[model samples]
Target: MDGTWLDHSRWPSAGRVLAAVSIMPALALAGWLLAGLPLLLLGWFRPLPMLLFGGALAVALCVYGARLEREDDAADATVWHVAATCGIAAASAVFNGIFHSEQLVIRRDPATYAQYAVWLADHGSLPIPYGTAAFGGPDPALVPSSVGVYDYGGAIVPQFMPGAPIVQAIGHWLGGVSGLLLVPPVLGGLAVLTVAGVVARLVGARWAPLAALAFAVALPVLYTSRTTFSEIPSLILIFGGIALALDTRARPRAAALAGLVFGLAVLVRIDGLRDVLPVLAYAGLLIALRRRQGRGERYARMGLPLLGGLAVGVGLGFLAAYSLARPYLSYLSDSVLPLLAICAVVLAATVAGAVLGPRIIPAGWKAMRGGRAARWLPGLAAGLVVLVTLGLAARPWVQTVHRVAKAEGDVLNAKFIVMTQLANGLPPDPSRLYYENSLYWVIWYVGVPVVVLATLAAAVLARRMALGRGFVWLLPLAIIGWTTVTTLWRPAITPDHPFASRRLVPVIVPGLILLAVWGLRWMWARARQAGYGPRVQRSLLAAGGALVLLPAVVTSIGTAFSPIERGESAQVAKLCEALPRDASVLIVERVTGERFTQVVRGMCRLPVAQVRPSGEAGAAAGANADINLAAPADVTRLAGRIRSAGRSPVVLAAQQAQLAPYGPATQVVKLRTRQDERSLVDPPNGTWSLTIDVWMAVPPTS
Candidate 1:
């Protein structure tokens, strides 16, 4: 149990490393089967049952893993620490994945993602057909709904980056519909492992597990990881990329791999470009500084490989987008060629600057290096001044952005404005949800002292970065800062619960946790220097750690144990099971219809279509449709059309009133519904006892 055993010099053997890696997936598989098998056997592979079973099993595995790690010897503790971290992450993901609403979380975003995955599983190609008749011609029933599908050149395509779908498709291929739900959790677990590895590199191995544990239960991390969201995958790649980049000095291939991974990140989410910007800047800085090496030699050793890998990765990304997502580009009224050209130009310019600019600015570089404070302080001051001046100058542009967002029916922005007005009783109030709520949420989980500690850690890290002691860590810090500012500046359009806080998970939570750990380590080091005995120092550290982690632990308990709102009502599942697979369904209400269409097509494996009320086609279709069942002629024609298609006609209405004209529905299903706006922090609102009526009618005497 020597302290030296925990040193970086004591690397684990390859067998141990492989064992550590293998244990996670094995545990994950065990957890998944334990959660899924009971429901599978009981014929209740639905949301509620799966969530309960999966959550319990995951929790048990995490607890047991932690206990086992606690009992391990220091000589082989590193492997156990890694296994425990991965186990906790995997367990959390399994629970979250199961606990996530069985239905798509956000109708537009996730539904499209699920559909894309489903299509990939089935067809394994581009240009997903909206329906059987989608490619033949324009059918009003087949028109792209806002719920993630887009109309593109007489074809229907998913309106999203394909990275997440491609990942989810693997799940679909493996486990069918339920498998898609597993993708995010698995990626989530990997992301946690990556974060732990990064922390171990930047800080120490001892701190890695704590950081990972903090992140595993973080509200944003837990919530987002459960859903079929793109952010999880993007985070995994970005974190992994950064971790590899940090190791570039020792392992140059790691830099190449990092660049390739980042390139794939952009392929997953266009916004990932923002995250990688700092890495690019850092690479340029490395090239320009040429630390302890000849300029051309340094470029060849570090710059060339990184750039080449970036070029290759980006080129592959463009190729994938153009080849696999052509329909999506067409829908956006854009072409991939222009984007590819632009990226190529950027890459070329970067290389050219790295190669030529250093020579041109040799004297400037020397001068800047000669006086650190004189150079940096002025530059920093000027940058701040420019930022302020730009903020003042761009007021009109900012207003225009808000105006445009509002016009585009941004619900979050509108809600923010309303909330601001209600809170302050003022006109033209900018939304401060991100700024205000971010701090509150952080405190809600990690407590106020940790926030202070994190701030102090940030200052310390900034100093270390300024001294060039830990320059590699700066890129990730920059990403954290940039994303935090931008996310708070413009939060996603979502209810305050999951979405608002969820966006901050990838960077903010991890950044804060890293800083807190650094602060704790700093305090412990100071305590040791002040002549505290080993026993006293250990006690103080343990007490301090408890204080730092207690709030988050308590909050996590409440969150983890809370009942998840079931996405699909039992009645809906019953209806799906009861209805014939080939039956043609005519949904009277637009919102209900579009939402259910995905469920029917993807989960139930049925063909479903919607019919808007005559004059209400465009407007009513946008929101909820008010179907006029009193218009017998319209109902008769729709029923006749359904019957003509060689399938039984089944009509579904959200309201009983909408079904009266059908002369007594064959079945009426009462459903418990809640307002879609929800958050993990808040308890569920009271359910609305709504009824869905289903009618089986003969062809209207055609």
Candidate 2:
């Protein structure tokens, strides 16, 4: 080896690690081919251990890569990071498969997004049952079910910003829902790498790789990046926009790219728009400042390229959203509000600029030199703008939220209670392994420590040195503002709020890591100033290491124990396997459950079809048709539906244990795992009652 090559001894080799990450996608595809295609061909069979084993192997590869560095060549770090991210991303996909799926059979909100992707890709719009289906089969699709338009059955599916869904749809067109599920992480990984590149450019080489690793392993990003969620996509746009703006040299193409990304980011999460408002305002102020300096043409030149980029991104976003939403225009009132408000704000800002251009330039100049007040004035203005925009956007959203809250009262309460406790400093419950529960507590418990430390470091750095002072603070401030607003406004408990910890995934994770790095560097500089002894420095390093690693260690343990339980899919698959396929079943749960049933029917071609509750339910129960009870009331109604059918169809009860009537007739099939799930049946009794309480499922009568 040449002398220039970095050492490569202790581990298998860089080539091996890089190969490990690249090989994951191939392994995942193989699993799908083996498990998924086989199930599709051979009447549905359980593929649990196969899926889990594949996922576990992928995760192991990622974790192994995280620790190994056979070679120390700085240039090779990017390859390693990419490999780790890709490998981890594939692992996450496998894990998601073990838990929830997008098909109607799995029937959950996360799966609902997947189903929606399939529907859109196939039909260019949401499925009819999505809007028209009622909560539980006993109810018509048009009935006022609590699950709302997006709920699959268990968790509330997030309303993805246009970019993510469109991209997901494209993936679906290629390889179905599984393909769509893979897209978010891929895009997210690319974004993370881009941010690392930006950091390498801005900060010195010493901190960038560490910062990149920190972001990659961040619990919030890891969890969300594992799913087909929108937060990561929005983050990509926001960071890409910032990177575009920070290029310093006025390249129109770069500015245009920045604008395009900003436009796309806003479409993914409107909150992202709020986060970047200050950046956009800064861009304007920069232009105005340049003009005042007698660089009017140069200012226009800078503005034009960015504007062009914005146009391209927004145009694409609108086309995507319009295509997806065309069939459900009635759903528009809330969806379009943000876009309208944005238009209004741009117009108003343009007018204000025209009116105050001369006066504001001087004030802006004063604010630039202005002390503490001036230092914060820009942020304050941006905050006010965001608040105002939210208010305007709220008009169409209020009714939708109220409906979702009332319908999903239990889930809403649970989400709210958990989120509130997390924000207030309560430890997470290991038993509650739902995505919302794990994410909410994890964000508060893990995120707060990282953010607080990073914020303090940036504050110190800004004060102590003049080099890249405000610029260094810009990304952190945008992140803080966005994180703060999201934590407060889009609380886990909020009705219609997509309940995933992944929503917090952002470029800020790396930014914070860099801040922590700066803090260490700062302490060392101070140690030198004080003429501290070697022992003192060692002690400081030890203390710092403890502070950083303690919570991380705790969180890692928590994550291991708190694997998410996608109850709906697991239960449904169990039901289908145990029940007779030819039997007609009236499956009922919450509104979310009803949606799940419909989706499963679409995917699995199940004989169950949810119809509006009729007085004749008692009559239909006895006719060899299965009466599957999912919700609370379904228990009392189950026996009647059976008696009405004339013959006892096997009954499946969810949640409740007691089988009071037709005692000998009831045969129970309970789900045995760490998860708390049970199903009781009425075997011999001709007409029996069954309560359906699992996440999502459609059963046959055996």
Candidate 3:
């Protein structure tokens, strides 16, 4: 190893490095909070604070960076890496927009997110009007039957965290409705670039572009970039934070910056906090171990600022949520205060343990004699393996207990179970879908060999960690492992092709890419050490890269040109255009109503209600139901009520049978839609054509 490998002086300037990484994102976050929080608290949106604070902070950072000394080491290589990453990201974004962009809102969650962004752009604050006047009152049925809208205190508020909406709002402000479509792809590109930077830090710059390419072209990345999913931005922050943390040894401020970024990630998605728990542990371990090695002062100087910055970031995140997203925060009301208190206690406990526990505990003192107990480590490992094998042999009984426990809380697990049922139906053996779909999606994308190579890379990294070296690399491994387990345990219930694969994009795909790259690099080094020529090493590496990437590239080519769903049909658009702004729309089928309520409300700016059959509005039923669709009398009564409220009542039904009792249809619209035909356990094929009748009837003249 060269001495320059450990020397900070050979690296680029801290300012340049920060510019290449986190500074812009941090500023943008600060600016967003500045502009957004005040609007939420004051009930008015103002752009001045955002511009002033963000502009001033950016200038200050630039000025400070200018004062720092500069170092040069192959500037062209850095530029190429940056350009390559940016190009890959841009191409991926374009590809995503072309194919995966949802024309009409199909999924409830994305629709809600889009609406929240629209609300933010227009109202610039919370308590988005339920637009109840269109529905004639503050009835629960007036609420859009979307997944992320919460009915709280007689008002409709978005249930998601504020981070992604705030980002989407930028797009809404810039380009109106079209801008919302543009935001995710841009963020997706940024995520790709950020992951490249992370790979460069963890592995080497030479491999960074390839890692970025692998991630940018993966099915998960391509699919997610086309929609306004929060995962994209969360990924940017997480990987960027990790990359920034790697530079902390050279630039102490980098640690604080990394902490702030990670903290913001939690604000974007609460699960991000769980993902970063390993980082906290890693930091604490560094502090404790360094102190025992008589490097206490240096470690404290760096670690304390990092911890403090993390607290600052977390504090700001909660503050933003409390001020701007109070209604959404209400969902977590029961646990928030307790969770905060617990976090504070844990932080205090960890700091104390790092500082004093090492001195007080006998195990800490005995660590100086570590060589004596090291020999027993192999025997202990063998015994643990034997015990684990025995446990696996008795797994059936253990699984039964686990199954019973899961069933006991079946309500909470209902969504995932429903997804499995949707994908595979009520089979004699049902657990296979969950496990099989999880593996199948991965295999479908990168091929089985790449999966094996990634596994090998993970094993190698694990071995390195076991040897008590390269602890820094453990963060990515921990994130990948955690996300993979959680996703497979309960993949999201989306009817999209690839079968719940979207959930794995942020961590799993990136992790696997990094692992594959590592594996290739390791192989090349081994080949060279074995006296192979440069040409052989290059050929081997190229072939490995191609094998790892070919499946995804081929799949993407096929799927990218043929989308599953088109935007709103021309006929539906015409109906929306013809419908009066004051019209009240009612959907007959409970399921279809819940799905399309947001589309009607958002696209047509009309209040829509769903009618459920009596006894169907159970505890788990959606919050938007006005009348029973099954009863002709109830439908007639709701129509009368709509007339009494001085609004035309329009009914939409999936079948002619549904509309027969109401009256003759006003018009029939044909919609070619994608239906989830998973009961047969076949891969979802092309769109299905369905005919829907729109009906309008006059109130009785009595």
Candidate 4:
């Protein structure tokens, strides 16, 4: 790499900057109004087609806007970055709105989100519900016994975090489902932006923006932003925590901040706690290890700030738990308090190890140093023995893994396999492989290569550190890797492997920044060594960052353009919106409109009617009696029920072709999709399709 290339020329001229800034605002305005304004217009009059047009035009405008006026001034480039990032996030949100009603059933753990949203709407200020089993409390008549009271309603539940839920709750209160749909991604976007800022500050200027750009374009981040999931927010806390840890100056304050961020991470997903353990444990270990060299006071001085942070963090955790899992906070002492106690014990142990290393462990020290297994056995056993002494130390984990595996297996065997057998056993779709395939592509495209270069950069930087300090500097990496490997092997890990990137994010994020800083210094040194021009070195470094980011950016954009099932809940939304406010709701399918509607209502605050059906409405029996009801019937039977009621009850029909038994009156509403648009693509053939059909009869007054 040419050394002179690394140095940037003076800012491309003020005229260029002014022109760039001017063009950006216009591009931004166009992008912002493209979908938003039309949707607003649709609300006033021409809704359906306007919404469709707005969406199509918005996508086009955004694609156009991103390409206009390309120059890379850090400040101006940052503006473009902000615009492009926002545009993609908004596009995902719009897609969410259009397709929300299609799924009929909540995907993944969105049910938990629904439960919390409903709790928030019913109560004021979050995570403050009574009893267990989500909104409306536990039903003794329905369940033999409460399996275990979980305060999923409060702060501890990631979905109901202070920032995310408060926003969604407002949305739920103001506009209902529409508000909820918009809320998650906005929070995700903010978190993403915050993470980007932290990343840029930690890494060199060149790498920071590019790293942020890669994340902005990444599919997983985009997907997380669009859905009511906590992954992105967890990402924010993890990165923030790591960045704080890397700051050498203000050690105590940084540690405290890191603790607070890690605490928030735990609130997002109980599993998220695993991500921060390496940093926290390693910091303590380092302090303890250094204590024998008469650095105990210095380590204590550094660790004191974190003590305040720990208190604040635990308080925040308790607050989060109380807010999200309010109904079950009392019982949280079992699940949460123990972990707090254990962490405290570890902190104390670290302090003790630091203060009394030689005196307290003289016997073990001799044995460990001598490699005498028998003499060292008690210390090792003592550590294990202490761990085991904690009540239910290992059983809870075993039980949880067993329960999840068994539940998933039974469902797959019974519902998937047996049902397929009854239906002539359809072959599995190949297209489904694309999900994991996309992930693999991204890992290779971005993660591995970045990691390799980063390691090289780290090695170069390590040469700058004095010998002892160099090894100590690398300690964080070892600790982080060990924690990551342990976490990945956990049985309950996310099935999405590339999501492992998110798991390693705390390390990767700060690590990259540190790498860039090192790489910059290394480039300077290399330039000096080769006697190359500073300008060339700077340019090469900048180019190096581009090399790392471009493939990721290109791959992500390419993946986004791939044909996917559009509007995951499109038909479901239509069904709900089409239904009269008074129409009784019935979901005959296992987890159809009834569950979706509950989530929708919980999310949106719409007063829908729930009703009981004529036959066994097994799956949706617990839906609201008037609007959230599930009516199980044949097409004719359903028609007869509608006729007998002498009014249309809102019906959501899935696999509408099966209702051929009913006469022509069983009209299914469908959007006329335009196939002529070259840019627009449909899901490739052989993909399993789920479509929702919303049906309503003509009002008598009309």
Candidate 5:
């Protein structure tokens, strides 16, 4: 892994620096989350307590980091090492700022995540108190619910795990909405560092900048990092966990910290539980007595601490899910048991292997360990990976993936798929899941060269793992393979580019990028062995690096500089200003209620309720809704009740005519912004225009 540019031999490896710094972010996030969740469940998640607690944890992290053992030889890091890392981070942060999305309205998941964070930041509590007293108690005509918020016993409960919001709440305290929005980009830049660290450890430190540059320009990385999505932070924890696990410094603490970090990812995104499954298996593998040099104690030390940390982290996540976000858990009931069952099965199997293998199947296990079988398995494993890729690539020709639209989300996703089909000029197939085209989706952003190189690298790595080789890549390959196969198999979200691309970013995108860089390094090494001159070797490295980077840059080129959802904070501010102070807000329109119910309640500091829909009107996370609110009579009655209770009733709708019966309709929010681009059959090149207009009026007291 010789660098063609300057001699970087004396530089401290990116891996070492990563080991030193990666834990801080994860520990901070975990510290706040672990402290915040219990308080939130008990309605005590305030700013002062959280700040103090977080500060204490930050201090502890610094002390712990200072105590980590540093090898004196590679201890001195070069200025170039620090500069390249910081420069990459700076560039990524700048890119995020340029294209940062203010998805403040509750129209999609990003907006939902944003609103959830805003509420947490401002109120520091869960199950937002309904403030039913302002409207003079409960009425059948009024509902206190919004898109991703559910009503429970007169309180508003935000859907989704509290981890992401808890992390984003820091941004709110730092500044306000702008600061809140800025956190994601900063996290995104940190993500660049995390990925580079993984590459430096597994690949060469020389390749860290290349990995950083490659993923920095990747479409999914760009898209997820610019908004309040859980993917970025989860990525940091997952990759940081990987980096920590590979770190030999302060072996016990490092292993334990790595486990804790992986566990916390489950708190951020539930999919993280599935993403870390391989680690669970790896833990078991380490626990099982391998006829090796270090003996059983060596493996147990590594395994036990990791297992303990993972347990605590997972326990915290599930506790938060069941307590703070029970409705979200209910909504995902169908998959929850299966995920747990799988985890249980993996855990049980791991236990069984560790406990019983020596007594029952020693010969067979030893044979598999280093016999002819072990030598042949790598080639077979590599071939299997290629075969699997081919199978996925050719799947569309033989099968059309589909999901039964039984659940509300499934139905909406079906509709989105159909719409995306129409947009792509293909025949509308409501049932089409497009899972068969998963391989093509990978190709769309990374290009054919990356796909090919990554596959080769995966195959090579697969072969290398058989005889106790390439220990650094063992868990990474497992995590990446496990997630890639499963996500591509069943992407359960809407089958649209950029939107569906999130499924790829967490592990798959960076994992493949790391592999592609490794594959190029592998190629260079082989060329060097073949007596190729330095010039030819440099040419090979440059060409391969270009293959790894160029397509991702080209793919993200369109939206890289073009910011979507711009001016959204301004529009929300304007709308908040238009709402009269001390006014009891009654949202009569379905879409308006869905988009602004919580906005008014939380942001405008008004007691707001929406008319209970009669029939065809329901809230939407990303689905299209009709402009009509069917319960004007219900709303009028509610307004009369509000007036009698000594409160002025304000009506909100999408159009002037809708609010005409109440009073003069004044458009409060005329937000014109760009929506995230959607493409089912191809790569998304640009964004679509989104126009949201909110009309408001005050009803007569008479």
Candidate 6:
């Protein structure tokens, strides 16, 4: 094999070792996405088939990867580095496991994702059934859908893409709810390992552990990993794709696999489509310029496979979106159309360039690449990065970001922002987006030092790439820099801590930290070249690592030790068990229906519906609730209809008194848990006490 970047044997030992650890989990996730969707369509998504099909696909990938070889291959691994990476992976799992959140309540996205997985694990189907037969028929007062699940043509469809829940369903299949909760943490561990793998490949082997530790201890990593957030899995795929692409320098077959992994990120999170645009451009450029990937291997082996694999992965995502998640896709049409247009433009331009560049003055391309202007580009690009960052940092002082609510969720988000403002003692401003302070969000977690170092590293990478160097840093720099600036500029989520922070978890935070660690290493090497004493060099390195680790750890420390949404799973279990067998449950109160319609239907595996809000709950207990509820006459008619249909009718409510109008209320679920803090102006501090109660009654059939 040519001794180029593609030859894995030449990479530092830690890269090879970390690669082995990081690759499997990512591939496993991709395999699930590949295999699970079709089976879901067929209503055959049981554990045994999923295990057999998805597992076989993953094994095939590993076997194919194992065949990569070279005549000059040298030992490319060290036992200790392998041990450290494995240890990092294990520690992340254990830490997240110990602090795992039980977010089963249907309040936010995490709970929504959890419920989605719960349905998949239990039923192995899409477009959840309304089970309206038990209620005699559908009534206007009784709707099939609730929060996080949409009702289209009387079918209960879940919100968001199916990728995260599929992984979580596997966890549930293995060990029930406990296993499902464990999935995110395990993915988190895998993500930590993958981040280390990237650092080993791009930075240096010695910096791998520090990178792993820094990323592992950060707030977003812990927060996302402790719950069923899509970001962790997306993180795994993004970095894992990069690692595979780097391996393609030796194993040409791995190029398609890398594309598959990168493309699957769209399935995990829709925003991932935006995150991977650079790779698409880069691959196109490689083919357009006829760059050598290996000895005698050019002409789009990497480009074609990368694009093909991406199409398959992205095609599956779109298929699922149009078929199973149409409501979710429709809800996102405003953003989705523009994103698709951008992707089309990028793809068209890439094709145009590849077709035209060779035919239209090929030698001129080289001249420009090697020209005097190219020599000066590094400095100019580096300065631009610096200037842009400084400008963004100063942006909040001069301008405040605002957006009008365009949808139902956006309206709620605006109210949430107003509520948070009052909590923080600020004047009401519903349209305030808080995006201008996105740079400060970085500083709040990683501190000024890591951000500074990350900037330095980014500048250096741009400079080196300008001079036709820094191949290793190119993709990392592009993906990270592009995603960082774009996300911070328009986070596009509710501007509350822990909620808005999820935007930073997958790419922005970890990528910046990885770059900062690499920057620290560059400085150390420069110091040695400057003839500094070993002690001085060591001191500088230690301080830099501390700056990287300490602030992040301190920022996350309080929330790290305290897991929120405790006792939720147990409460769900109790509520499900307490319902009478063959019961057609109907919720009278609004909050109860919104929070438990999906939970009761999915987790309890029972037929459930909610009556519209009465608008007569004048007491404080029900006064603050949202959602539409029905009058007592309407609820009574629905229950009577259920009774006449040969089903026992039960009424559910948040308070015992809310059920008093129908029958004697029995408290089924009494839960007290801790909730993540919702800080708007400041960083998240700690958890808040959260209490929920569920009451049930079997209405008299007379």
Q: Write the per-residue lDDT of candidate 5 for residues 1-702, one digit (tens) a residue.
A: 567457666644544555455445665666666777777777767778887776677567545653452543123344466468668977998879777999888888998998898988888777788877777788887788889898875577898898899889889888899999999999999888878767766776677788888888989999998999999989988987887777642365468777888998989988889999888887766665442323435444577677777888888888888777788878888877788899999999988876675555457757787678876787898999999889888989999887778988778768877887887888988998788998888888888888898999999988887655876678899999999988888776777878889889899899888888888889899999999999999899889988888888888998788788888899889988987787899888888898988888777778998887665433441245443564556777788888778888899888888887787888889988799888878888999999999988998766
lDDT-sorted candidate list, best first: 6, 5, 3, 1, 2, 4
TM accuracy, model 2: 0.59
Question: lDDT tens digits, residues 318-409, model 2?
Answer: 55345433322334445347646866686468546644665786776576665676566545554563453345334334422222223334
Better of 1 and 4 by lDDT: 1
Is candidate 1 or 4 superior in TM-score? 1
Which stretches in model 6 have alpha-carbon errors above 4 Å?
A: 1-15, 66-77, 291-301, 359-372, 614-629
- Superposed on all Cα atoms, the candidates' RMSDs to the truth, in angstroms, are 9.1, 12.2, 6.7, 13.4, 4.8, 4.3
Q: How accurate is candidate 1 locally (lDDT)?
A: 0.57
- Candidates in order, TM-scores: namely 0.74, 0.59, 0.79, 0.57, 0.93, 0.94
Which structure among the candidates has the greatest lDDT?
6
Number of backbone collisions per candidate, in order? 1, 39, 1, 58, 0, 7
Model 6, 575-684: lDDT tens per residue? 88899888999988878888999998988888998887755543433756433545778878988899889989999888876777788989998998889898887889
Q: Write the per-residue lDDT of candidate 1 for residues 298-383, one digit (tens) a residue.
A: 23356556656656655555555565556555543332445445555755666666776667556654666687764475446435
Q: Stretches of candidate 1 above 4 Å error?
A: 1-11, 14-77, 94-100, 104-108, 130-146, 289-292, 295-300, 316-352, 360-362, 372-408, 411-441, 567-573, 615-635, 667-701
Which residue ranges in model 3 land beyond 4 Å of their true spot? 1-38, 45-79, 103-106, 131-147, 286-300, 316-349, 357-369, 372-440, 465-468, 485-499, 554-558, 569-575, 615-652, 655-664, 667-670, 673-702
Candidate 4: TM-score?
0.57
- Model 3: per-residue lDDT, tens digit, 1-702? 767888976766533452355334543554454455545556655345545654455455434433331232112246566667667767877776666554344344566677767666666677655655654554433334445555566566666777777777777767767777778887787777778766666666667778878888776676668776778877777776665565565565556766766777766765565556555655665566556655434333356556666666666667767655576555554445554565667677678777875575447446623775455544454354334324433444444311221332244344555565654545433223343355456666666656767766676676555555566676677667556555544453443355455667767778778777887888888899999998998899889888877877775554445554454445446767766677788777655565566556655667776654554533234565333453455556667677778887777765655677666665534555553223223333333343334444333433
Whichever of 4 and 5 has more lDDT, that candidate is 5
Q: What is the lDDT of residue 158 in candidate 1?
A: 64
Model 3 worst lDDT run, 10 consecutive residues: 400-409
